[model samples]
Target: MRLHFHPLSPYSRKAMVAVRLRGDAVELQEVDPFSRGLRTAEFVALSPYGKMPVLETSEGPICESTSIIEYLEEQGPAVMLPPGRQRLARHWDRLADLYLMAPMAELFWRRDTPLGLKAPAVCRKTWGLLAQQLADRDFVCGDAFSLGDLSAAIASDYLVRLGLEPPAPVAAWLQRCLAVPAMAWTVELAEGHVQRFLKPLSAEFLADS
Candidate 1:
């Protein structure tokens, strides 16, 4: 199977972490989300949404980051989540997707625009809510790691980049999550992607416009 993604995409990172943790023999394929190539009929055939982290599997292509992660979970021992914590996992997943992904997307057009400046404050609020949830738990859901932890790990990168500190417990949890080998690798790959890879999209889009 091939996982199409860019390391900078939190959604993609979430899926990648699950794949690596599962020890699945899937291949990684970099897809530039900023490029019009994603809109071409060919890629769209695989993912109707034409988004990253689409999994090309023997059964067929799986679109959406959450969907791909769920697919990968079925391939192995299912350690990415603890039993009965699926609801909590889904909650965190939605939190990240709704809050973080939106602002990260603004970096495309608002990378230098006044609108972009507004994103961080909005994002910080969401981070506070997340921190409140993690006040008593080491991980997002609890003591055991779950998909929620992965979601928070990815979303919190925004706060880190902004140099904004989450609550003490949330900050501690972020450190612990990054210490995991798979997550460490994910963060390393994601480093500088915003500056080097994704920021260029703003220029490219303006030129095309």
Candidate 2:
């Protein structure tokens, strides 16, 4: 199996985390089909929407990050997601993608669009909501680490980049997630890409140290 993904894509990071934490290895291929000069029909065929993080399997291609995770779970119980509480985990993943990633992408990549100017405000509200929702939990879906927290950790990185200090509870949650070894590895995969595309990277994420 192979995963075609962008190194810094948060969606890709979550799926990658799932694969690694399962104690399995899949070939990884990095691509940037979204770049104007790099786009190609072959890439489009691999992913109809020309997106990154498509998993190529013996059966066929599995698109979408969450769908790929679900495929992994169906194929083996070694999936990183917890055995139960599927609904809650999925909700956390969706919430991060919607509230956190959406605004971060608009601000970082689509700055010229009309929504760009409002990105800060949108992210502020999102941060507040997530902070409140996460107020009493160490992880997104309770005390256990699951697929939900994996994606949320990546979103928390963007939340830091957004420059609004995370609230106390959220900060505590971020600390716990960043302390995960897999999270550090994922961030190392992401840092260079983010530094190349957005801003200077920081080493503060090594919270375990």
Candidate 3:
């Protein structure tokens, strides 16, 4: 299996973490989505929608971060989805993707616009619910890290750089999630990409200031 991903993408990071945790020996193929790498004929053939984090499996290519993770779950020890907590994991994963990751991406790329300005508020609203859910638990689902924690934690990490810090409970939970080796490795890889992407913008801001 070959996983096509970009380090800077939260969804891709989520899939990568799942692959690592599942102990899959998949090859990692880094693609620059910003450079139209996903639009190439070879990549588009694997993923018609041209999305990052496509897993090329012997069965076939799987697109969408969640779908790839789900497919991995079937092929491995079910560490990401678990047995009884599958529903909760899926629920939080969807919520994180929709409420946290989606708005965070908008804010990231359009930080100077009105829509982007409002994005942080949307993230905060979701973080409020996440805070409540995480108050007594180590992770979104419970003691064990699951898919529930992956998407939310990755998004929160990036959102912090955007000036939208998670509340106390969620902040602590984020730390615990990052402590996972796979999560830590992916987040560190993403930080390098993010810094490179932000350096020019930071210089522009400093010049204006």
TM-scores of the candidates are 0.82, 0.85, 0.91
Instruction: Report the lDDT tens digits of candidate 3 across residue range 84-130.
Output: 99999999999999998987787677666765556667788999999
Q: Identify the runs in model 1 with alpha carbons over 4 angstroms from their true place.
A: 107-118, 197-209
- Residues 1-209 of candidate 1 have per-residue lDDT tens digits of 99888888787888898888888988999887777857878789998988777899999999988888887776757777667887888888787777766665665446556655665666667778878887787887788767887876776765565444566667788889888888999888888776664434333433332
Instruction: Judging by TM-score, tell me the better candidate of 1 and 2.
Output: 2
lDDT accuracy of residue 152 in candidate 1: 68
Ranking of all candidate structures by their lDDT, best first: 3, 1, 2
**Top candidate by TM-score:** 3
Candidate order by TM-score, highest to lowest?
A: 3, 2, 1
lDDT of 1 at 1: 94
Which pairs of residues clash in candidate 2, taking residues 3 or more apart in a chain or in different chains? Answer: none
Provide the lDDT at 107 for model 2: 63
